[model samples]
Target: MSGELRVIATAGHVDHGKSSLIMRMTGMDPDRWAEEKRRGLTIDLGYAWCTLPSGREIGFVDVPGHERFVGNMLAGVGPVQLVLFVVAADEGWKPQSEEHLQILDVLGVAGGVVALTKRDLVDEETLAIATEEVLERIAGTVLAGAPVIPVSAGTGAGVDALVAALDTLLAAAPAPEPARTRLFVDRVFTIKGAGTVATGTLTGGCLSTSQTVEAYPTGRRTRVRGLQTHKHDEAKACPVTRLAANLIGAERDDLARGHVLAEPGSWRPTTVFDVTIRPVRDLERIPSRGAFKVYAGAAEVDAKIRLLDEPFARVRTAQPLVLDVFDRFVVRESGRQRTVGGGTVLDVGPPRAADPRHRSFLARRAAAARGDLPALLIEERGAVRADDVVLLTGGEPPTPHDGWCVAPTVRHAVRDAVHDLLGAFHRLEPLEEGAPLGVVRQAAGDAARRAGAPRAAGLPDTLLDLLASEGSIVRTSTTVRLATHRVALEERADDVRALLERISGEHEALPPTVKELLRAGTPRDVIDAASRAGTVVRLSPDLVVAPSLVDRAVALVHQHAADGITVSTLREALGTSRKFAVPLAEWLDAQGITRRRGDVRFPRED
Candidate 1:
């Protein structure tokens, strides 16, 4: 079985000859369990394969048709794209047949062939009526145009025609997309000496021997020790086919039917997601609340639904599942024991609240095609790391900027917010040269939150630096300011000038302390503005002096060439107390104008 591989699942009611039809088509027994063989009922899934007349291979996944085993049937058919719908000619249409049809339609099965088996049990007139009933039942379904073939496994009649019809369906089927590798495990067991083995339909990409894969929901890593498709050994097996992989790193107890084996780190298991759900064809309305089980890719878990808007809801699963956007799923009410509705996954990560902006984002995702979703994510998220975009969408981001995927509109909004915040700061604090970097960052974070994009709060620093490099803002070592922002004296010009004159003249040697000036009716803003303008120098938080006085002190320190000056000598020269001289001398040392050696000070040499 080479060329190309296609998988098709058999679906119908119990005892409708689904397994018998597969046995006739492939010459193999589909009822794997002994109880199933004795009871003549498919209790679980079965597998068989054969090559068609066109040299194309087809794998058959036989699913149980009993209403009690619908969960088993869903696991078998969830990952497949085509179905071999069976409806016994004598039984006509049963309850299970309609349920199976609904499942296939919601799963997005592309095309199929309806097998009206047990042809010998019914007369020609009866068979004609039964076929018409099936046709009417499938009027608007995905299999509306499918060919209905009458076949008898006991008499071996019409079997050849059924084979030919399947060949035609396979020829017209679209080629599988080359996506990341994903295999849903419907069966997990330990093969004597080969360790743990998992079997399921591989749909995403190809799997090669020795490839590393991770089990989802558990995140256990393992290596594919061996690969087999239809019991034939191969180094690499492509998708859209049934595969049995021999695994090495996990025990049989660690893996289960609902678990998934995927490429290492390629998938993120999620507990909550947004979806566009619709009630089953005939059902009027689905339950808005209560526990339901979500079935997707051979996995079923208890879930709770919240209606965000019409046909859109948020599903919170009891257990994490490896689900992606656009993946089809079925929701069954556990209490009623019926599939109420099904839906397409729209978002794997949704905000906590269903705000208006979030609702609009979901609407766009629902309307856009698969390839256009990544860009929509960027637009809604405002900004995301480039690598994260790939991990989320399985594709490169659209028009990345500086290694980040960003929306231009949102970026512009954040920039405007930054400018407004800076302008407000300047108006309130004209004495300060600029806002502290930490304060600016806090403002940027607040602005981002107001813009409804808190995840992009770290983006402000990068944008701020970019703006500074482009000459839009002035960025210092510790502060940020608009290019046009400047500290202005304004109405306090005369007060600041008078303070500067007092510091350089009468109080040149021992300038008034900052606390004293404030007590004498000198506004702190005026004193701060003069200090920022270099009209006065601050030796400490409480001390202020004239620059001319500092120059004189430096000259006196260098005059003592033989030895560095002591604090007491500096206090005598300045005619001030130790409080002012100690801080002033420390300030000179900090400025590299003089060096202190224990109790002495010396002029620094360049």
Candidate 2:
């Protein structure tokens, strides 16, 4: 059986033996810079790996511990699950140790093992006292109850015990599930033959050679030429492990350390985002407005903070970064040069705080557990495309209602609005059988936007069909109406009867014109209502005739079945003038009752 692969990072004060501990355990020095070895300090991030006793392959990210290199430290620890915390036995806990612990706690590192390095420099009693102090300092931190093993990198004593502890901790760590691939580029450089190489901790999903990837901030598309982990070439790289990908189609100058390589179109880059934050350590305040640096993934951005309410705030960056909800971030007061706090991202591309729905949405997010947030977001949105839900929340939509994740309340509201709009349309134009399809779509789209489902604008055809399937509305190929709606001329019955009598009895073959009807005391609406009721047919803007006259016209055309009928022939047959015959012939052709060629007509084959 193969054990799991995991990545762990080291954190402590400057020169606290974090690099030395990794070297002793992994048989490879983590400090890669020549200056680092000569200066006896780790400067930038370093990487090394080793297999544990249980066969689990573990990678170590060695981070700089100096106060000035805290940004580098944050980049290393931001994406990993386990921590190898180092506190010198002689020095116990220092300023950087306190700062590092606070950072780990806020960033939500789930598991840890504290290393009491340089144990050989202190006696047994001093070592015991140092262990006690470290425990007290980390009591309420993420490393609480973590094993503190005393070790000396020079003599290699107790290094075995620390390794065993790490293996045990990793054995209990949750396994990484397959997901969308995201690799924050912590290191970018060029090789002799490789065009450009970017390295970072891989998370979210897997990366394989020849796959297309996109870089954030730059938005450059590139392909992976090759992959490597622990100095060995690999065809694929998995999550929660350090990875270096040789990229094609991009110059080394086009990439940078803070950039990210992800599956094309998998991430959205935004300069502004919302988060729920808590102050770190004894810090009691997070200023509503200030210059701050946000450290997330492998990116550090300058930003301005705005407080919406307690624990809820918005940060607008000077440049864009790829981010997701539930991602952890650390914030440092730019001027003070100290860790202020960190938080979990709640929303990316949030609406203005002044928007009416902003606070209410945040309230629901605050009340939801991490796993429940995606579903809650979909519910709050009313309806969203299933693909969009995955992109926005990094989780699948609860259940797609015909490709849209719909909330019951918002769906009901939209349905009601559709009914109301159709009702208004019927009241205004009672002579029409139903509303035009385009008009109903426009009205339904407005209602959906108001109900919190912006993507449902124009109310997709599928949703319209769904509404019809539920019997909320009746729809034809070109029109829509409420199921309960019907066209009725009962209130205009007397006027309709008068209009029909004038058309059928007074002017049967050549009915009265629209102007003539009005002059003869017939209201225009009554004429229209009679037409809708099938008592009369309006063949033209000015011509109104009884349906019986149309039947007679069709009978006359059939009487000439031996030869195709002409407009002149129909006029003579009906004893009417060419004015009525021309429109009547055209109407027959349009309805496919007759097919016209030039001036003659023939019965349609239908």
Which candidate achieves the best TM-score against the true structure? 2
**Candidate 2 Cα outliers beyond 4 Å, as residue runs:** 1-3, 177-179, 354-357, 378-388, 398-407, 417-470, 474-481, 553-563
**Cα lDDT of model 1 by residue, 1-606, tens digit:** 367889999999999999999999899998999999889999999999999989999999999999999999999999999999999999899999999999888888989999999999999999999999999998899899999999999988999999999999999999886566789899998989889999998988778999998998898999999989999998998889899999988799989998888887888788989999888887987788878999999999999998867888999999998877888999999988898889889888777887888889999998987788778887777667777676666666776556666566665665687788788888898777788888777666666556555456457676566567667678787888899987887657788877877787778887788998999878898887777788789898888898987887887898885788888888898787898888888998898888878889888887
TM-score of 2: 0.89
Candidate 1 segments exceeding 4 Å error:
383-395, 398-404, 424-433, 455-471, 474-477, 483-606
lDDT of each: 0.86, 0.85
TM-score of each model, in listed order: 0.80, 0.89
Give one clash count per candidate, in the order shown.
0, 0
Weakest 10 consecutive residues, lDDT, candidate 1? 448-457
Model 2 lDDT-worst window of ten: 454-463
lDDT of 2 by residue, 1-606 (tens): 145778999999999999989999999998998999999999999999999998988999999999999999999998887999999999989999999999999999988999999999999999999999999999988899999999999999999999999999998888775567789889999998767899999987888999999998688999999999877888988887889999999898888877889888888888988888889978878866668999999899899888777778888999888888778899998988899999888887675543547767877776776677667777767677777777777777776766777766666776887788888988997766788888777766666667776654434565666689889899898889888876678877888888888877657877778999999999887786676667788888788888888898788778776688999998888888898999999988887788887888988877
